[model samples]
Every structure is written in C-alpha cells, then in structure tokens.
Target: MTYDILIIGGGINGCAIAREASLLGLKVMLVERDDLAGHTSSASTKLIHGGLRYLEYYDFKLVAEALRERERLVKAAPHIIRPMQFVLPHENAVRPWWMVRIGLYLYDFLGGKMSLPRSRGLRKSDTLYAAPLKHGGSGFVYSDAFVDDSRLTVLNAIDAADNGADVAVGVAVESARREGGIWRATLSDWRTVEARAIVNAAGPWVHQMLGSLGVNASSNVRLVKGSHIVVPKLFEGSHSYILQQPDRRIVFAIPYQGDFTEIGTTDVPVDAPEDARIDDDEIAYLCEAVNRHFTTQITTADVTSTWSGVRPLYDDGASEAKAVTRDYVLELDANGPALLSIFGGKITTARHLAEEAMEKLAPSMGFRAHPVSRARVFPGGAIADFDTFHAQVVATWPFLGEARSLRMAHAYGQMLAEMLGGITDEAALGPNLGGGVTEVEARWLHDREWARTADDVLKRRSKVGLHLSAAETAAFEARWNAMFPREPSYA
Candidate 1:
C-alpha cells in the first residue's frame, strides 16, 4: 500500500515530522540510514533554551520561537527536560555591562509569558554563583533547560509509532523516481515502496538525497562542525557557566552526569558531514575558554570523552559559520509528486519546523493537517511532576536504589514500570552486564526502542558506555551481539 508521506532522515527534525504527520491522521513512514539520532542529533550540547547568544546576532525572532517551544516541551516532557540555572560572569567580557544587561532584558521581554523565571543580576562576590570564579565582578543569572537530546529524538519516533507511523531505522533509500504522480522508491532492504509525498529531512545528507533523486536545490548547505569535550567535574555547583571568549564567541561549562563536566563547542567550518571529529586544537580551545572563568584549570589530560557533529546550516551568505541563521527553510517541489527538502534548523525549533512542514505539504497531500496540540505529551511523558514521579519509581522498585531509580525515572519516565515488567526484586532485573546494563533493560531497548547494536544501547539509548572501563565495555559489546544478530543494511 502506498503511504501518504515518506520522510527521510531520523534526526530530531525528521522524527519530529514523522510524529506530527502521523498524529495528523496520515499514513506516515520514516526511513533512517542509521539509528535514530545516530549523528548530529545525539552530539548536541543538550540544552533546550532560547539562544541568548543569538541576541547579539539580532535573531530575536528565532530566540522567541525557541523560548515558546521551550515552555511547551517542559510542560509536555518534564522528565527528560528540566530547567537549569546559568551564571554569566562579566569579567573582561567583550560586551559592555549595559549592553549585556539590555540584551538580557530584551531576551526576557521577548520570552513574553514564558513560565521560566526572568534573568537577574548577580555580583561576582555572591557566593551562590561566584565561588568558583577566577575573577571578581558582576554578571547575571538566567534560566534555561537541559535535555537528553538523543532520547528526545527517540521519544518523537516512539510517539509516531504509537500513533500508527512506521519508523524504520538503519534503512536507506537506494533510489527513487516520480511515476504516475506517485513516488516509487527502493530502500536498502531491497523493497519497493510507494508514497504520494516525500519529505527530505536527511540533515547533512539532505542535498545528497536530493541529488540522487535527480533533483537540484536552489540553495546550498553550509556544513559547520561543532565539537564538545567531557572532563572531571570543574565545580561543585549544579548551575552552568556561560564563558565569553576573547573572540566574542561563547562557551558553556555544564555539570554533566554525576562525575563529569561537559564543555564545548567550537564553530569550525568543515566540508563534509563525515569530517565531524574533535581535534586536539579544538580541545585546547575549549579548555582555554573555560579556564578563563574557572579557578580550576584543566588540559587535554583531564579530558575523558569527546563528541563532534556537523550542523547543516543554510547558506545565508553569512561570512562566518557562527553567524549562520538557525532558522529553517522548507522547499516543496510539486511539479510531479510532492517533494519537500528541509534546510538549516536546530533541535530547539524542530517541533515547530515540523508543523510548518506539514502546512507546506498540505495542498500536495490533498488535505490539510489539523494537527494536535503542539504541547501533546510524548510517549512515557504523562507524569505531572517529575520529582514526585521519581519518588514513586523508587518506591515501586526498591531494588534499584536511589541513584539507579532516579536515573531510570528520568530515562523512561512512566514507562519504567513497563520496562521492569512488574518485577519487584533485584534478581528479576537480571545481571549488571556493565555499568548498570541489565539483561532486562537491554532487552526492552532492543525489542521496543529499535536498538540495533550495542553502540545504540550503550551510547545513544543510554550513556552507560561513558561509565565503563575499556575491558568491561568490550565484554558488554560481546554480550549484546550474542543477544541480537546484526541485520544486513545496504551502504
């Protein structure tokens, strides 16, 4: 049977589009060449906030749009996304005190009824936010949010599947042609499928996907590589620090996991998506950035793990990669069967982009989508209050202990009970394969969440790989492979 929509790419944007279209009563199917969020979606700074730095670039609209989405997402998925405090110290800063203050004030004003607390002034001597600072002065404290970026993408896919969409991971499109007003496509699985419309949200490879279809784009994709580094905890506070570099760029120092600090991201221009890998120079740049603000200094030796992803930004004629617009553009070519290609968007605005994409394709689809509320809750996101729900999870599974229960509550939310399979004892949870990897949880991810490989389970589904030794990681990989055989996917 021919589907109403076939979306390419499994990043946040693609998954979000699938979720939106599927929920709007369309027969939607999304195909991904790799695991969901296997690329840039999983390699983000993991924050859900209006880009405060974008204010300097005069992207007021983008910031406001993101702030609105931030409010909606926090209400819809409280477990995976939560508010966090950021301390912006103004010591030898590039922007003047008054300019910074006005920028933040404008930011708050633009937010306009956003539920988060407004930004406030903070003195460098204030111990609450200044104890770890290397210099003394005044700055500001503001509220944003943190997120499990990979899981956010996964949650969207799960919601789409729950709403009757076919989500195919590790599936590639080998070729496609327009015939009789229908898109006849062959996928990596050697199966031919038909769709009335196709949405190309292929991220960095979006242009490549278009080229293969013999379609040409009017605009080009600017590939910018963003890199991040993880190290031992820098400070004892839960609040993150926004460090202003001498080059007028900003770097973030965030508290990560339980024992590490996550800092990054360098805006280096790259030619290809596959060129995304953190370099020693990038590592030194991030270290130097944070060192300017923190009393505790670190170098490459202190680094634990690192990640890099190439952002596919629109070629907006910006002179620098950092200056590119985060706004997305949708190109719908409908001379034949409807074909839409998405260019340049961030995770924070993906949901809205999906909504706009649906509207763009409505005429081509022969019906407009009366989409559900933007705040519609994702799968496992029904809990009203996360802290209260967390306590209940600990109570339900006493064997998981406080820390493990808290982690599980955040990861699975209301679905933790389903994952536990009504088991009440530790023995029922199975063995700790490595770093809290249990036979039960791994099986659930494999069966329910489309975890194809151990890497998908270890790195993306959960960051347990970060907590394991080299030997233990290898052992867990062997065990995972023994549990599920690898599927054959085309190149």
Candidate 2:
C-alpha cells in the first residue's frame, strides 16, 4: 500500500518527523533496519541543553532555538526529560571568569521564560559542588536538562504509531525508483511499498540513501566520532560538573544511574559511520580528562561502561571535528517526488526539526502545513511536574520501595499505573530480571515498546544492564528469548 510519507531511518529525527506527519493527518510509515535509536540517537551525552559551548562559535541562533526546545521537552515529558543544573568551574588559565559569567548570562537570557532556575555564580570554597574541583576560583551554575535518550526516541515512535503511523523495525529499504510519479521503495524482503514523499532522516547513512535513489546531492556529511565512559560516582550532588580541558574543549562529569558518574565525549574523525567503537587511547583520554578536574581519580580499570557514536554533521569546511556545526540542515528536492534529507541535528532540537521538515513536505504530500498537536506529552509522559507525579506514584503504590518506585516513575511516568495495575508487590510482577527489572516490565517493553533483545530492555529502554550481574544478565537473556522465540535476533 502507498503511504503519504515514508520515513527512512528510526533515529530520533525520523521518528520525530513520523510523529509530526502522522499527527498532521498524513499517512506515514517509518521503517528501520534495526531497533529505534539503535545508533547515534542512543549515544548522546543525554543532555537537553542549548550547547553552551557553542557560544564561542558564534552560534547564537542555534543555541536560542535549542534552549526553547529544551523547555518544551522538559514540560512535554517530565518523566524522561527533567531539569538539571551544570556546575562550570572557572580556571585561572583557561577562559576568564568574566567570560564564563557572561556566557551563562547570555544562556539564561536566550532561554526566555523557563521552568528551571536561572544561572548563578558560586564561590569556590563555599559549596560542596566546588569542593571536587582543583582550586576552584569561582564557578557558575546553569540550567540544562537530562534525558533517557533512547527512550525519548522510542516514545516518539510510539506516539507516531498511536497517531496511525506504521512503524516497522528490523526492516530496510533496499532500493527506491520513481515510477508513474510515485516513489516505489523495495524492502530487503523483496517487497515494494510506494509513497508520495521519502524523508531521508537516516543519520549517518543519509548520503548513502540518497545515492540509492540516484539523486546526486552536494551536501557532504562529515562523520565525527564521539565516545563516553561511565565510572564510579565522583560528586555527591544531583548537579553535574562541566570541566574545562587544557585543549579548550570541555568534558562533562555528570551524576549518572544513581551510583555512577558519566564522563565523556571525545570528538574524532572516522572514515565510516560504523567506526564508533572507543579505542584504548579514547578511553585513556576520557579518564585523564576526568582526573584533571576531580579529586576522585579514575583509571581505565575503574570504567564500568563505554559507548561511542558517529555524529553525521554537515560538512561546513571546519578545520577540526569538534568545530563542525550542531545545527541541522534540511535539503528538500522538488524535482520528482519530494525528498527531504536531514543532516547535523542534536536530540534537543529534533522536534523542531521535524516540524520544519513536515512543513517542507506538506505542500507535496497534500497535507496540512501545521502539526495537529505539538505540545502533546509522549507515551507514559503525561505528568505535569516530575516531583508531584513521583509523589503520587509512591502514594498509590505504597508497596513499592522508594528507589524502585522512583525508577518506575522515571521509566514509565503515568503509564506505570497501567504497567502495575491488577498486580501487587514484586511477586506478582514475576521473576526479578536482575536489578529492579521484573518480568512484567520486560513483557510491557516487548509488547508495547518494541523491545526485541535483552540489550534493548537492559541497556536502551532502561539502564538495568549496569546493575545486573553477568550470571543475571545471561539468565535475563534466556528468559527474554523464551518469551519471544519467534522474534529475530538482532545481534
């Protein structure tokens, strides 16, 4: 059957576009070769910030747009997207204290009206947030946000599906050819599907998809590799630390997963998109970056988990990988059937990018220009405020422990009720799949969230993988396979 729009790529951008198009009353089909957010989307810094560092690059417009979206995301999905404060310690040698303060001031101003608190200056010796730093001169605390990056992508896909879009995972578009004024795309399984327009939001593979359609596009995509490492907790507070490096590039040491600290992101160029694995040198670089700032030193041996992703940045003729623009560029080809290609977008600005992309395709697809609902909450994200919602969740499920209840509230939001209804206590929820992950949650993920593998449930859907033992992880995998024996193994 022909669809009004066929979105290629299951990353955050494609899913966001799918949700927007479907809500705007267009028939949309999103097909992914792997799980939703199986790559770059899941490998973000997990922050919904305005890219404060981008101020140095004179990217005020991008920063302002992202700041606006950050607020929207926090309100739309209070469960998954919540406010966070980042502590930026001043170093005497690097950027001046006045410059840091000025940047923070501009960032706050760009944010406009916000639910989060404004940025503020802090004394070095006064607060515990400054205690870990090496001779903290003066520091600034600024508002940003954190997110369950993979879950956000999945929620967008879920929202799209709910709005009558067909979302298919582990499916590929092998080829596409324009025939009789319609673009006919052939899937890997030798099936053909026609669409009025094709959106190439394929992240790193956007150029390759365009090539398959025999469209010669001039926009070059530079593949930049970013890698992160997780270690034992360093700081005491819920607030995160943004440390300046000798190289002028900054690394974030964020409080992660309750027990660990997340530090990362080294920008390096790679030949292919799949070359996202962190090397020994990259791991050492991250550990050294952390050791430079915090009193708590961490070596490679102390590392718990590491992830790497290739950013499909638009080639803007920059001299360095880190210098590439984070802003997205949409290329709409109106020659035959409409083809909208996206490049260089961050998770924070995905929704806005989708809205803009839909506007570009709407004229060709014969759909309304505006999305039906932009502010609708994502699946399980109906909570108005996170704290109030969590209090209600704990009050309703009094049997749940504080830690477990909070985890559930963060993972499922208001949908935790549906997940826990008619079931009381941990026993009725079935066997503990290690950590707080129960058989009930796993089944809900499998049936509702399109979780196809053990990693999908343990790592992407939730961070239970970090809490599980090797034996427990194996057991969880066994149970998962038994539950869905017919599902194709992805890895």
Candidate 3:
C-alpha cells in the first residue's frame, strides 16, 4: 500500500499527528508495536494542565503554550477533561507567597481569554480549602484540568481513523529505506508500504529509531523516570493538593477513581525507558511529601498501585534531573524523503506538538497543511455543556444506572449515544464482565479502539482493573483470552 505519510507510534503524539495529517488531507497510516498508550503515555499523573513548576525554570513559552492548550483541550473534550481546582498550602511552602501569586497572575494572563475561574488566595480558616491540610495556614487555589489520559489518546486515534487514517496497533515497522523519492517500509506482518514522509513519535524509543531512519542527529535524549503511587482516599474534598517538598520538588495528591488518592512524581534519572519501576527512595519521598502537606499520612504499605513512566526528555545538560526541560524538540531530516522525530513532550501540548510536526513536514511531504487557531473537538467531544450532557445521558439511558451512565458520559461523551442508542434493555448491553464493563463494551473496544488484549481493555481502555478483585480479574482475563487468544495454536 502507498500512503502520503506513515506515522510510527500509537501514543498521544503519534495519534495526534495522524489526526492532524489526515485532517490536512493526507493518506496517513500509524503503526504501534503494542497497544495504544502501552507505555509512557498511559502512565501519566492523569492531568491536563500547564506545568506550574516549570514557571521557575523561566520556560515561559512552554508554560503559556501548555496553559493555552490545556484550556483548549478542556473545552474540546469536556467529557474526558474537566476543570480541576488545585490548592497549594502556604505553610512550609517551597516558594514565597508573593512569588506564587506573581506566577499565577502570569499564568492566567498567558492563557489569554480564559473560560475557567482565575486563581485566588484562600484563608486558612476557610475549612473548605483547609480541612485536609496538616497546617492551619492559608493557601492559593488555581484552576487546571484532569484527563482520562489513555482515553484521550484513543479518541484521537479513533478520530484519525474516522478521518481516513489507518491506525495499526500491535504492529511495528520492522525496517524502512528511502528509495525512488519515497520511503518503503516493511511491517512486522511482512507488508511493504510506501509513504512520502515518516514521523517517529515512538515516545521513549524515538532516539533508537533515528539511526534506522538514516538520520545521524546530534540531539540527546535524557530519560527521566517519573513514578506515581495510588493509595486509599487521603482527603475528603474533590480539589487536589499541590504539595511542595523541602528539596524544591512538588508532588500532587489528587482524588482518583472515586475511592483513592493518586500522588506522584519524582524526577529520577534513568539510562533506559523499558520496565521503569519506582525505588524505595522515590516512594519515601512521595510519602513524606504527602505526610508534610495533608493531615492524613501514608506509608509505602498503603500504596494500592504504582506506575512509573519514563520521560524521554531532550537533553539540555542540566545539573539536576528535576531541572530538565518538559518542552519537546522536533527534528526533521529532509535529506531524502522526510523523516521527523519528536522528543520530550508533555501531555498538555500533544495537539500543538502534532500541529507543529505536520507544519514542519508538510512541505517535504507535498502537502499544504491547514493551521488552526484553536483545535477542533475529537469524535465524541462535541458537547455544549458537559454536566447537561451527562444529565441527558443519564436520562436517555436510565437502564445503565446513574453511576455507570456518569462514567460512560465522561469517557465516551456524545459517543455514548452511538454505543447505546438502540438498546433499550440493560441486558442487551451484554453480559457483565466486571467493574461495570460488559461484553458489548469489550467488543466495541476491540472493533473500534483496537483493544487486542485484556490489559488493553481493562488497563488502558478503562481503569476497571483497579476496581476488580484478584479472582474477578482472573475470570475476566480468562474470558477475554478465550475470545481473542494470542496465537490460535491449532486454530
């Protein structure tokens, strides 16, 4: 098969790039070695926010651009992304109150015309903001957004497919060579395809792909491991806490999945990205940060789950790991057919990164890309108001139950109608798999979202694994294995 552009990787950046390229009228094909978001993309703090700490690095452009993108994403995908309030306590705060205020003022200004509430100072006696704090001191509250990170990536992939881009998950580009003014690539399935340009958005593995692309580049990728630990519910409020550590790093304790609090992330440098795991020191640091900020303390034993994502940051030769830039670097080698490599991007700016990537490669690929002032919503994100839409979902599909309907509304948005439109009975939704997931939903995930494995369905496609018991999960896994066995041994 011949295509205008071949994108390698199925993470957020790759999916976003495919959507942008396809929307710009390119016949695009995106290939991933594993399931979509099977790596760094899924293991995030699950936030869509401007890097508040990045302001100290004087990365004003990155912060402002991220804040703007955060706003746009919240508006575009209100179901999966919503405005969240963050409280930074005053006592034992790393930075002075004046500095934080100034920073927040700049943050609000950088966002230009804003839809969310502005930042403000809160009194310590104001128990609503102070109830969960360890100290009876004042704090600063600012607005950011929370996201279903994996779902966002999947929606972008789905939109790319809907826009005529072929999203090939569980497939890898075995080899590629530039010839006859086009790039011929061999896939793991032994299919040879030709494309005018290639985008290497392989997340942590981006640098390793460079040599094969025949682009001897000088840029370095400093792998930074950021880990998060999930523990039982810490605080009462819906608002998240931004706890500043004594070492000048900040950790967040955010409400997650209704029954637990998720806290993260230490910038521990690593040599490799594969199989990243948190060490005792990192866990201690996170626990201590939470202990110092909140009245409810936690130990390592309290950690219900943990995830570590390796950030493949563009090396800037910083002395400290925490000082590394969160901004991405895009290198295009148009020596022959175009080859673009992306490094070090925050989830908040994936769309913008994709746009810039397409803009950079459009000329070489023989396409005039259309630039957008603000990005369009994903396939299922067209909602005027999220709460009202949720209410409509609950009213329309009363059989799904309010709790299930609410979760579905957030995850699928307007797509819920398409999934559950004609089904009047709950049983028609399919047999219960566990954690509110059904056979029908699993089938939909497989057919539409390219969910091939149990992990792809429960872990990435949905966080149902977090809520299931060991036996329940095993049963579901067994059933899923039966449905889509990896290798059909004998057919």
Candidate 4:
C-alpha cells in the first residue's frame, strides 16, 4: 500500500511527525535503521525547559516556543515529565549579578502560567542549598521539567502506530527517487516501498540522508558533539545545579537513577555523526566544572558511565559549536514527490515542529489542513497526578516494592495494569534479570515497545542497566538472544 507519508529516522521528531500525520487521517509509515532513539534523541540533557543560555544569543522566539511546549508536555505526560528546580550559583568571575537577574526575570515572564514555582533568589546563608556549594555566593533557583527522553520517542511512535501508521524498526532507507510522482524507497534489506510524500527527520544525519536521495541542497548541518558523565552522587538534594565555567559555558549536575549524579555536556565539533564518543579531555573538563561549584572534588576515576550524541544544527556560520542556533528549519521541496527535511530541533519543541511540518506537507499529500491539540496524551501517559497514580498502583499490587512501584508508574504509566497481567507476586514476575529486569517486563518491551536487544530493554526503554551488575547484564543478553532468535541485532 502506498502510504500518504513515509517518515525516515525513528528519532523524536520523526516519531512525533508520524503521530501528527497519522492522527490527521493520513496513512503513514515510519522506518528506523536502528532502535528508536538509539542515537541523539536518547542522549539528551533530559530537561524540558526554555534554554536559558540561549537568551544571550537573543533567541527569545526559540526559548518562548520551548517554554510553551514544556508546559504542554508536563501536563500531557505527568509521569515522564516532572517539575524540577535548578539552582544557578552566582559566580562573580562569570556572568554579572544584574545580567543573571535580568535573564531570570525574562525566563519567568516568557514561561507564562507555569505549573512550577517561579524563579527566586537564594542567599548564601541558605544552608539547605548552599552547604553543598564550594563557593560562598548567592544563587537563583528556577523551575524546569525532566523527561525520560528515549521513552518519549517510543511513546510517540506507539501513538502513531495506534493511529494506523505502520512502524518499522531496524529498517534503513538505502536509496529513494521520485518515480511517477511518488517516493520509491529501497530498504537496506532490498525491499521497495512507495509513499506519496517523504519526511526526513533524521537527526544528526539529515544532510547525509538528503545526499543519498541525490537531492543537492546548499544548507549543511554542523555536527556538534555533546557528552555527559555519570558519577557518584555529589550533593544531598533533589534539585539540580547549573554551574558556570570561566569560559562562559554552563554544566549541569542533575540527580540520576536516584543514586548517581549526571554532569554534562561539552560542546565539541566533529567531522561525522558517528564520531560521537566522549574523550578523556571531556571527562576532565566536566569534572573540573563540577569542582568549581560543588564542595566535592572528582576526577576521571569517579566517572561511572559516559555517553555522547551529535546535534545536527543548521549551519548559520557560527564560529563556536555552542553558539549554533537550536531552532529547527524545515525545507520542503515540492518539485516532484514532496520531501520535507527537518534540522536542529530540541526535545521540548518536537511536538510543535511536527505540527508545523504537517501543515507544510498536507496540501501535497492531498489532506485537508487538520490541527491537533498539544494537550493530546501519548500512550501510557494519561495519569493526571503521578504520586496519586503510583500510590494507587501500590495499593493494587501489595507485593510490589516501593522502588518497583515507582518505576512501573513512571515507565508504563496507565499501561502498568496490562503489563502486570494480574500477577501478584515477585516470583510471578519471572526471573529478575538483576535490577528491575524481570522476564515479564523484558517480554513486554520486546513485543510491545519494539525492543530487540537487551540494551534496548535495559538502557533505552528502562534505565535498569544502571542498577544491574556486569555479569547480570551479560546474562540478560544471552537469555534475550536465545529466546528472540529471529530478530536483527541492535547496538
């Protein structure tokens, strides 16, 4: 069947666009070469906030759009997106006090009718927050939301599938050409599929995908690598810290997996998207950034895990990688079969970007202009209050422990009932693959969430890998391969 839209790349933008198009009564198909969000989408800072730093570049429009989306996502997916406070320590050596105060005021004003508390100034004597800081200076506390990034992408794909879109994972679009006013795409496995229009939402590989289709476009994407390191918990609070460096860049130290601290993000330039591995210099750099603000000092040895992702920013001739704009640009070529290529979008604004994409391509695909509500809840994301819903889950499942109950509530949300399958005991959960990886949960992700390998289940669908031992992780891989022998392997 010729789908009305064939979306390439199963990252957040592609999945979101697929969901929007499918809901508008268009037959859609989304094909991903690897696991959904196996790249850039999953390796994010995991914050749904207006990029406060972007204000320095006079990017008020981008910040406002992101803030609005942030409010929408927090309400639509309360379980996955939760409000968190960020403590921005004042450094006399970096940004001036007046400048920082003005920026905070603008941030609060732009984020109108926020569900979270407004930004406030904290004195140095506020022991609760200041005790952890090495520098004895006042700071500003602002509100933002955190998200389960990979799961958000998967949920979008799931919603699109539920709306009659065919979701294909581990499928690569090797070549495509305009044939008889249709996109005839040849897959890596040598299968051919036709679609009326093609949406290239391939993150970090947008330029390469267009090259493969023989469409010569002038705009090039600047590949910027952002790396993060997970270390032992540094502070004693649920709130995160945004530390400013003497070099004018900021690093965030957030609470991760309940026990570890997540510190991140160095802006380094790279030649290719595949070269997204963190180096020794980046580790030392992040450690130094944390040491500047926090009382505790860390080195490379304290690093537990590290990850890196390449951002495909639209090349606007910015000298520094950090200065590149985060705003997305949509290029629609209506010369033959419609091809819409997206570049430089963040997780917070993906839904809005998807909505605009459909608006541009609707006429070419022969669909009337149909608008979707930003408040539309994703699959398993219907709970109004997370704490209340989690309490209800614990009440229903008396055998579930506190940690397990909260994990289920956050990961599965309303779908926890179906995942539980009326089972009532830990033994019935079937083989705790160390951490929270039970046979039942593993099978649920494999069959329902398109998780092919142990990594997909342990790392992406659920962060159970952080809790699992090395031996247990290896054992889970062996079991998964032995049971699901028919599917392709994933990294």
**Top-down lDDT ranking:** 1, 4, 2, 3
Score every model by TM-score: 0.98, 0.96, 0.97, 0.97
Candidate 1 per-residue lDDT over residues 1-491, each given as its tens digit: 58999999999999999999988999999999899999999999999989999998899899999999999998888889989999999996999999989999998998899888899899535686788888754789899999999999999999999899998888998999999889999998888899999999999998999999999998789999999999998888788999999999999999988899999888999988999999889999999998888889998999999999999998899999889988889999998999999999998899999999989999877887665758698778899889899988878888898877888889899888678866979998887777777899989898888899989988899888888889999999998988887867674
Q: Write candidate 2's Cα lDDT for 1-491 as tens digits.
A: 99989999999999999999888888899999888999999999999999999998999999999999988898889898878888887763388888888988899899999889999888545578878877764778888999999999999998999889999887899889888678999887567899989999899999988998899777889999999999989879898988888888999998899999999899999999989899999999889888887777888999999999999999999999888999989998888888899988999999999999988877776766875545777888877678898899888877777998998899889888888998766688887767777788889998888888888888899888888889989998888888877555332
Error of 4 at 429 (Å): 2.2
Model 1 local distance difference test score: 0.90
What tens-digit string does per-residue lDDT give for candidate 3 at 176-259?
Answer: 999978999998877899999889998888878887666787778889999999999987878898888888998988999889
What would the per-residue lDDT of candidate 4 be over residues 1-491, giving only the tens digit for each residue? 68888999999999999999888888999999999999999999989989999999999999999999999999888888889989999863488888999999999999988878998898656677788887665889899988999999999988998889998888889889999889898887667889999999898999889999988766778999999999999988788988889889999999998989999889999999998999999999999999888789998999988889998888888999989999989999898999999988999999999999988997776777666858798888888778889999999887778998888889989988888977988889887766767788878888889998888888889898887789988987888887677555331
Which portions of model 2 show Cα errors greater than 4 Å?
124-126, 371-373, 486-491
The 10-residue segment with the lowest total lDDT in model 2: 482-491
Best by TM-score, which number?
1
Better of 2 and 4 by lDDT: 4
lDDT of 4 at 42: 92
- Indicate the residue-level lDDT of 65 in model 1: 97
Clash pairs, model 1 backbone: none
Candidate with top lDDT is 1
lDDT of 4 at 441: 84
